[model samples]
Target: MEKTWWKESVVYQVYPRSFMDSNGDGIGDLKGILLKLDYLQELGVDVIWLSPVYKSPNDDNGYDISDYQSIMTEFGTMDDFNRLLSAVHERGMKIMMDLVVNHTSDEHPWFLASRSSVDDPKRDYYIWRPGKDGKEPNNWESVFKGSAWKYDEGTDEYYLHLFSQKQPDLNWENPQLREEIYSMMKWWLDKGVDGFRMDVINFLSKDQRYMDGNILDGKQHGDGSPYFLNGPRIHEFLQEVNQRVLSDYDVMTVGEMPGVSPDDAVLYTGEDRGELHMVFQFEHMDIGGGPEGKWNNEKWDLSDLKGILSKWQYRLEEVGWNSLYWNNHDQPRVVSRFGDDGEYRVESAKMLAACLHMLKGTPYIYQGEELGMTNIAFESIEEYRDIETMNSYEELVNTYGWPKEKMMAAIHARSRDNARTPMQWNDGRNAGFTTGTPWIGVNANYPEINAEKAYNDHQSIFHFYKKLIQLRKQHDIIVYGRFDLLCPDDEQIFAYTRTLGEEKVLVLCNFKGQEATLTIPTELHSLKATLLIGNYEQEESDTVSSEPLRPYECRVYLLK
Candidate 1:
């Protein structure tokens, strides 16, 4: 396999609003991130994927950007951002800024002009269509709920918004708009920023002929994703972006692409494609969901999870690279979703980390993940802050007439707010995140799962993660090794091997709370195996045994 800086480096994602608060204004800011540079450096991450910090109206917590070049006032001024950038580079770490060009806040100047009138100069900058038979242009559903098209009374037309109504989709077909986006990207690169984490980049190129989608769940609108996601000319636009701006810089770019397949991923991230370094696909995240979508409560199958991950690892091995991650700002904590978040929280968290980090890809660690943070169970719907969750609740309860208890159960399991809670810095007030009241309520378990406690404990999840990061740096096989799944059908164990040249390593992880036995295959039973690292205390053994492994145990064995 080819070698690259991003390929061998570990990327840490920081949701700025939940990381830390310096001035006690109840929100995390650039200054607060500047204060935690040492913390990140000590954790041994090479690249920091900072979530959107651009100027916004806070309609979607900074995703709905209003200004491309300016920093949000809540996050601090442009000078503060410059200082943060300098500090990060000084510490020998790169920063990947969130690029949210697929859509912009309605408050943005371009969108403001586009929505003014039909003959406005910037009217074509956004996707606008006339109503169809006194209804919306098409029966498309917004990701957050309701109609995707919002009627603009001023222009007597409808504007497309895949997300919240406040976010208007940009017209990628317009060369002028594309140029503006490229100019903004160049400005940041020239200002010493590393690269970008393109948000919903696949949604940029949409099908020109708007059409109604097949209705699902008996809703008034249907999922219009098929007409927009990975639409025609996506590659052309991305290649243009690479040629005009990205190719000129020595930076990394990872596109957040939902509903992308493995074959299509190759075209996006292939070494010679010049589109992206890698893409974050959501197939793994949607493992346990049913036909009703993410909110449906369905039991996750370990075998299915293993199959999806293994398929991606193998398919992308030669052509493209993978961006391995379990938790992000948009998803629930991995420990809570897939592992035992109660009794075996620490053990399962380590196991999940080991399983992901040992894969043949670049690993991303979200904020608060190292401390084994679990999902929060808000008692009341009013306590939820995420627009997606709140909107879903209203629709499910009021429109669908679903029981409040059922909706609340789904909200507790799938809400983005589960991951947006304040970072547990210490056991003090507000989990030591801020002196003032937090924008969202802190998890009630923060007293037991805060970073301070983990840092003080030698055997805490934080230290285990530190060791994993160190091991990745020490062993090149972990980065570029060829992956092979051992037991593809095991329901309680996830086992795989990484081979690079003559070096070979086997990783075994127990996914459940009960002890499971994994017998060594006769093909390699005679090989000497040295325990490299594990979650539990165990002496280095030079031979493979048939003994049963402990619950949630993770072991890495180097074979000779």
Candidate 2:
């Protein structure tokens, strides 16, 4: 397998708004990130994948970009961003900015111009259509809630918005618009930004037929995913961007692609494809969602998760690359979702980290995940800040007449705000995040799970992640080894092996709280096994025993 800097490197994602607050503004800024550069460097991450810090109206929490070139005033000035970039590079680390080009804020200059009048020169910059049958342009639903089309009084034409009405979808079919985007990207690359994490990249190219999507049962609006996701012209647009801008830079690029299969991933990130280095697929992220979507509380099966992960590993082993992650800015805490977040939060967090870091892909660690931060259950709806969560509450309780408690329960389990809470730095007020009031309430358990506490503990999840990253840097087998699943049917034990020539490593993870015995494959019983790393204390070090794994026990064995 071919090797690259990005493939061998571990990325740490920093949601600036919640990471660290500077100037007592109750919001995380570039200076806040600068204050924690040493923290990130000590964590042994090679790249810092920053979420959108561009100028925005915060309609979608910075996903709705109003200006591509300017830094968000809340985040700080361009000079502050420059200083942060230099500091990161000086520490021998790369910083990747989030590229949210699938759509722009309604307040964006281009969108404003496009919506001003039907005859505006930039009118074609956005997707707009006349009302159909005295209603919306289509039956499509906004991802947050309500109709996807927002009617404009000035032009009397409805504009498409896949997300919130404030975030209008861009028309990728326009060559002029594409050029403007490419130029903006080049400008950033020229400014010494290492790379980009493209947001919802697959949603850029939509089916021009403007066809109606199939409506699910009891749903008012149709699912427009089929008409927009991974559209026909996606490859053309990606290749054009690559040829025009990306090809000239030696930077990492990972596209956030939802509704993408392994086959589509292969086409997007093939070695010779000249499109992207890798893509973040949402198949694993959607494990627990039910037919009613993310709001429902559905228990995910371990075997099903193993099947999905194994499929991606096997399929991408030869062609495209994979970006491994358990949770991000958009998902709930992994320890709470998939592991024991109560009695064994630390153990489960370490296990989850080991499981993901051992995979043959670039692993992304979301902010505060290293400290084993769990989800929060705010007592009142007024305490919540996410637009999606608020919309869901209104739609389910007010419109559908679902119990408020049921909706709140779903929010506790699945809300993106769970991940957006302020990072816990210490046990002090505001979790040492800010002196002033935080924009979103800090997790109440911050006193126990703060970074200061984790950094001081040797057996903490934070140190375990540092070791995992160091091992990735030390061993090539972990980066390029061919993966093979062991005991595929076992629901309790998640086990796999990575083999590179004569070197081999086996990883075992116990998903449940009970002890489970692992059946060692008889063919490799003779090989000497050295305990590389494990969450629990070790007694026997040089043998691969068929001993039952402890609750949330994860161990990596180096066999020779």
Candidate 3:
């Protein structure tokens, strides 16, 4: 495998709207981030993956971009961004901006011009089609809810929007539009920004057939993913992107591709392919989701998760690279979803961190994750601010006749707002995220699971992550080692090993609340082992024992 700065570095994702409030306006801003640079530096993260701070209408929490060049008013001005970027670089850390070019806000100047008339030159910049038989252009439904096509009275046509109606999909087929995107990318790179985390990048190229998707049981809209996801011309568009803009700068790129398989990933991230450095695949994230989609209370099996993760690790080992993450701004907290968030919140959080960080890829830590922040079960649906969550609740309860309590349970389990809650800095009011009201309600458990409590205590999850970050920096084997799965059928124990030349490191985690025995393999019983890190403290002699791991306990060992 080849080596690179991103491949060996750890990334920390910061959702600006919920990170910290600087002006007491109930919203987080860039100056709030500037104040926390020391905290990030102390956490030992190499890269800060800042979520979309571009100018927007907040329809999708900044995902719907109106201006690629200017900063969001809620996040501060251009000078604030420049200072934050320079301060990050001064601290020997890099920052990756969220690139949301797959779609633009309907209020964007380009979209405003595009919707003006049929013969408008900017009309080609967006995907527009005439209504079919007095209905929508196609039977596709938006990911949030309702028809994907929004009829515009001005143009006498409907426009495609994969997400909200306020977010119109861009036309990647137009050469002029592609040039405009490239020019915007150069504008940012010229400002000393590091790289980009492209949002839904694979959705850029559509099938162009505009065919109706298959509607599943009890669904109102068709599933149009097959027509738009990883389309035929995706590689061509990506190659053009790389050649025209990315190749000119030395920066890392990771595409947020939803339905990509391991084979498709190799094509996108392969060194010889000239597309991207890596991709955020959604196979593991889709585990608990059922045929009815993410609006259910289905339980995910452990063996299935192990299978999916191992497959990616093995498939991307030789050709492409992987971007390892358990949760992000769009997903719920990992401790609540995969591990015990009740009695073992701290233990499971550390275990989850170790499981991902020890893998053969770049690890990304979402903000508040280092403090073992769990999900919030808000009392009312009105308490949630996420557009996806709100739409899903209305559709499932009022439209589909789902029990209100059941849908709320699902919301508690899978809502993206679970991760968007304000960052808990201290046990004070509003979790110290703001002096005034927060945009969303803070998790009530912040009193026990805040950063201040974790930072002061030596045995907290925050320190455990700091040690994991430092270990990855010190050991070359952790970065380039080949992964080997052990005990694949185990229900409670998730174990694996990393081998590089003469060095071998073993990782073990108990995924459940009960104690599970982890037997040592006979092949390496005689080797001397030293404990690298473990959530629970035990004597050094116990490192080689077949003792039962207590309730989400995790341990890593370096064997000689």
| Global Cα RMSD, each model | 0.9, 0.8, 0.9
Model 1 spans with C-alpha error above 4 angstroms: none
Q: Write the per-residue lDDT of candidate 3 for residues 345-459, one digit (tens) a residue.
A: 8899999999999999999999999998999999999999999999988888899898999999999999999999999999999999999999999999889989999999999
Clashes of 3: 0
Show pairs that collide, candidate 3.
none
Instruction: Name the TM-score of candidate 3.
Output: 0.99
lDDT of 2 by residue, 110-140 (tens): 9989998899999999999999999997899
lDDT of 3: 0.93
Clashing pairs in 2: none
Residue 474 Cα positional deviation in candidate 3, in Å, after optimal superposition: 0.6
How well is each residue in 1-560 modelled by candidate 1, as lDDT tens digits? 67889898999999999999999899999999999899889889999999999999999999999999999999899999999999999999999999999999999999999988889889999999999999999999999999999999988999999999999999999999999999999999999888899999999999999888889766778878889999998999999999999999999999999999999899999998889989999998997787657888688889999999999999999999999999999999999998889999999999999999999989999999999999999999999999999998999899988899988888888889999999999999999899998999999999999988998998999988999999998999999999999989999999999998887889999999999999767755677888877888886568765677799999988887
Give lDDT per model, in order.
0.92, 0.93, 0.93
**Number of the candidate with higher lDDT, 1 or 2:** 2
What lDDT score goes with residue 212 in model 3? 96
Cα error, residue 540 of model 2, in Å, equals 3.7
TM-score attained by model 1: 0.99
